[model samples]
Target chain A: MTTTVIEESFRPGELEVRPDGTGNLLGSRCRSCGAHFFPTREACAGCLSQDLDAVKFSTEGVLYTYSVVRQSTPAFEVPYAIGYVDFPEGVRIMGQIAGLEFDEITIGMPMTLSLEPFGENEEGDPLTGYRFRPAEVTND
Target chain B: MTDVHVVGVGMTRFGKHPDKDATDLGAAALLEAVADAGIDPRIIESAYVGHVFQGMVTGQRILAQVGLAGLPLSNVENACSSGATAIREASLAIRAGENDVVVAVGTEHLTSKFSGALTPDPSDPEAAVGATMPGVYAMRATRYMEDHGMTREQLALIPVKNKANAARNPLAHFRKEITVADVLESRPIADPLNLHDCSPVTDGAAAVIVMSDRAAKKYANGRGVRLAASALRSGSVDVTPTSMTFEPLTWATAQDAYERAGIGPDEVDFAEVHDCFSIAEVLRVEGLGLFEQGSYPWAVERGEADINGRLPINPSGGLIGKGHPLGGTGVAQVVELVRQLRGEAGDRQIEGAKVGLAHCRGGKAVGIEGAACTVQILIR
Candidate 1:
């Protein structure tokens, strides 16, 4: 089986690519107001502070809400699950749910970010993007 | 500021219009409004037109079709609130003493332009990630059910009620009452939102003639609904993640309208709100303070939101039953308000109705609660 060599990120700013095949969602943290945002921001929405720093968000989050999308535009396939996961940074990010059955998904479930094959580039190279999966519970 | 009144309102039958274009529909609605006002078409000194998907000079095309090509005109676009924004701009013009009589028209030939689920702008990150309008609302419906204990059966009643109201509205797209079973059995567009739960892609137009007190006195012929307030607001960027079950954008816009009208939610006799989806009606009415927070689904089940209920909601059948032509949706809401307030609604008339409200919230952008929202209150 052939493997991907040259990989790229669909959204370079929102989704960071790592040489090690693992990356985190990027967001902005306001230095003055202590607020965080998704997809990053130039200024703090709360205090309008311009002192912002781009940071990687935690991979784990809680599923706040979700839906099974049956119809969509031509870009994406149909019958995929989508939801918003609330990260510790106080930002809720929406993405397609992966690695979970439709019936197995529920609100308030613990989810961990997982990078997987997403789409192609202008040169038709496969790219890695992020999705959420159920965090494995440990038997303590 | 001078008191503004909707001297007349008109709307074309909302459904598939293969023969008519946006300009044709707009001119038809405009001429109807002018005739309804019992005034010469030349009395309209200025105009505002709202549309989306239709290209530039859409307003100019409508003016040319209506034979008022030389009049000063402006075209407005604010997502689904485009038409309502046009009305708000016209009201502001009178309040600013810019014009005594102005016409606002909203028209869209949506069936020709789009058929499937609408999306945010292509540049939006959400669009790139496969977000459909139905999918977003379905997620909200799921969250609302999870947060408020709203059952699936109860949510089905919203479409049922709206379609029943549509049966009486001659100009509505749907005239047959549907059942909760119909909603459950319909093809699923998104989980928790079936075909019936979503508004249709329609092609239609609606127009309203707003006049200052002086023009109203001459053209009203004892039929004028006071445009008490026309308030608009854009969605605030979310500094922190907020509840999907509530609409801060809708509340803020309605608050501006309430303060300007010097009235509270309790005084509103009836309302026509944007019900693009079944869940949207719940969010809008509750957000507008027509009902308590997290309580609209149960309210729909209790017959409290019926045509003859304690507080009538969507007496014109809303976007669901009446059909949603995007740009036309907002103006049609005002047309319904004017008809109900004037006791001109033939079969679905809300008798003795004096105060009516129209709410429109449209467009969805990433990181915001909503895109643009407008609230207009009318008193007769």
Candidate 2:
């Protein structure tokens, strides 16, 4: 595990983040059928169209549903709030809600995607992770 | 469409086998199946191989080891249902007149992928932070308990019963029977799901030989189990996204299978359902309409699903006892049903079994249930 900032333009297998530091999610737009995906793909899963355009998504969304996880596993942190957020673009993303008590998180809470620094790996490497933060965060 | 019959089924003992690779175990099962069917390898017209986590061209890798030559080979991966999906495809190909005889094989070497690390989804930022499979099922267990007043002891009974059944199965991964107290005493993987409630990471393979009705009558010994229906359905994304609730996909698939076979759930003598987690067995039993909602645990407690019960469930011990090798589980379930329908399960066999159902549900993707839910009905 190595820690380095990703500055070059790149296409993730599922998602794309713009270089403007705006934390907007990126997806592929099917030029033929206008189908959108959260994690952009090279081909349109709907129309099988190869002609696609990379598009940035709105950073803001509303919580669709959530679960306050009281248990932990190798896959996720324990005692965290995880849920799906519905963006205006008709795409839903599964993510973690930050800066809220497990009991405080509710359905339809306004949230915005944010880039936060995750902790080190086993070899002590820094990692940056993303989460859904309350819309009214003072720092942002 | 032409009918297809499963003439022979074979499965390697399910457990941690550090000595064998995926192909090695796959070929072992294939050999056993071929011998069981008393057919030469050359009789197989094509092969459908199912695997997950194995790299690209897994079918080619496995079949090549068995000296298979140029034939239509397709690799399938549908998460947990990969095995049954492969069987369905192979059966369809034979029915379509593309082949006279087809081999369906599924193998998993999970020991290679058991590294204790977060498998973050590259596409979902939330997945990057952490969301494990156990956590998702735990959420479901929590919700089910809260909604149905189900107890942890009730959930624990699933493994207790399955392990007891596994004790009778030589192919089971864990042959030791456990009590509900033992299940509750085990280490917690997630809230309400102790280590005993979860299926072990296993390495195994299961194969079945499916032949067209014409070929079966000509070559098979008239001992083949008929495949009445094989249906796959996916969950509806439009519904409220909740892991704990029963999804429509399972119901749709079960109904499709039942209708295709012209039989109802009441006609099913026994079933082998996906019990990746103990709570999942509860959901599947309810979702399949075998028992009323919120009555699965009660049914188990009353031995309604026992091997001697009116409607036995998981007579082969399910994923909990038989072990979920992911890709091999679905096919293994079919193998068990075939054995029961043939009256060959011995002590574990359901008495006078005629119609058997095998239901498998895979993991979730994008907040929905598995990408595929498959149900297959077999009749003697």
Candidate 3:
């Protein structure tokens, strides 16, 4: 058997990618209070608590709202569905909506995290980024 | 403490001006305002200038061009509130007994900057995920529709009303009026928001001269409009997630202005708001307590937001029809308010208007309700 090493996430410290290709979004949870935040934080906005713990967020959420972005900066190609998903952790996350036709995505739809090839690093290596897909949409 | 008054106002024709730089535009508006006030340029004891994307000593450059250098000047950048914030700073100087006369100028050479969809600061995680300003407002529009049963056709009427008002404004960017079908069929920038519904990337500048009671009593000649209240506030950190459909930031800022001005929402005769998008006008008015929540769309459909309606909103065409120049936007709104109150807004003047309100909110940062919000109350 050939041993293989897994690549790191496109944005280290925000998204975690394990050797087995399993991953979760990284964030900060206030140790003093129970509030959570996305992409991590130094202090809690809710209570001004400096004590925060890095935690992984749930993979499932419900779409809060969405838009078919037909125009955007060059960093993103046009005509992509972008959305905000409210996770069970009481945090809303922004991400690219994937795994469905433009017309199929609707508000309050169930969503699941799906990692995909986002961009490359300085060394030109592939990086796995995250997107939200409908609950029934599956990827290998 | 002295009451503040707007002694003079001036603006450049709001449209693309590839030949002129921000400094040139600022200087032009400044000179026009000085002449309009019938005062010597040397009498302006201090200045505040607002601009974005115009690099390095923007205010200094404007002062240098207009022969008003060496005076105390502060360049303000509160994102879209930059221009409005400048006006507030100028008023504070008078109220604090620091200066008798001050000039606030807001200019932006946006066409010289980047085009396409404008995003928040690139470092923002929202921008990282491909957040366009139109997309954000479109999402709000979608949610507003879902929550209030607002139809697409009702939202389309906002642009229609604004562009029609813009058609009457010679200094506005869009002099031609548009229709509901035109707004609906225009090229889509984001879902449920088309190019027509969005404010154009415009280049323009505006200037206003604020004076203390002494200066105004000497120079106003009964023409000056009183700056009753100028309030500024930053978005608070949300302890709990707030509704995007309703803006507490706007309400809080407006409440501050109302309290300071000693006027209620019902007393306002007209308004000029930051309508960066059609949905934004709905949000801004409702947030300012001008209309009931989820009621602006239906009110607009009933021809209530028109220039000749019961309560005219954005009679100067707003950002949608008038054009938005980031820093120039807020100042231009004041110019409209003063004009309408003076009965000088030619074709789109709100008749017999005694009180006019202007609201500006700008920028987006994570974990905040809004970046910067300013509310101003002007009375004749």
DockQ (CA atoms), all models: 0.79, 0.17, 0.63
Could you tell me how far off, in angstroms, the CA of residue A39 lies in candidate 2 after the best superposition? Answer: 7.1
Q: Which ten contiguous residues of candidate 1 chain B have the minimum total lDDT?
A: B122-131
TM-score of each: 0.97, 0.82, 0.96
Model 1 chain A weakest 10-residue run by lDDT: A1-10
DockQ of predicted model 1: 0.79
User: Could you give candidate 1's per-residue lDDT for residues A1-140 as a string of tens digits?
Assistant: 11332367778888887876778889899999899988778788899999999899999999999999998887788889989999998989888888778988899999888777788888888887777888775456
lDDT of 1 by residue, B1-380 (tens): 79999998889999999998999998999999999998899889999999997889899999998789999899999999999999999999999999999999999999999978998897776776778899999999999998999998999999999999999999889999999999999999989999999999999999999999988888898899999999999998888899999999999999999999999999998999999999999999999999999888888888999988989999888999999988899999999999998888999998788999999999988888899999999998
Residue-level lDDT tens digits of model 3 in A82-132: 998888887888899987899888899999987777767789997777889
> Sorted on TM-score, highest at the top, how do the candidates line up?
1, 3, 2
Candidate 3: segments with Cα more than 4 A from true spot? A1-5, A137-140
True contacts kept of 3: 0.61
- Candidate 1 — which residues are off by over 4 angstroms? A1-6, A137-140
Tens digit per residue, CA lDDT, model 3, B14-125: 9999999999999999998898889989999999999878887899999999898999999999989999999999999999999999999999999989697899998787
**Number of the top TM-score candidate:** 1
Q: In model 2, which runs have C-alpha deviations exceeding 4 angstroms?
A: A1-93, A97-116, A119-140, B116-126, B239-243
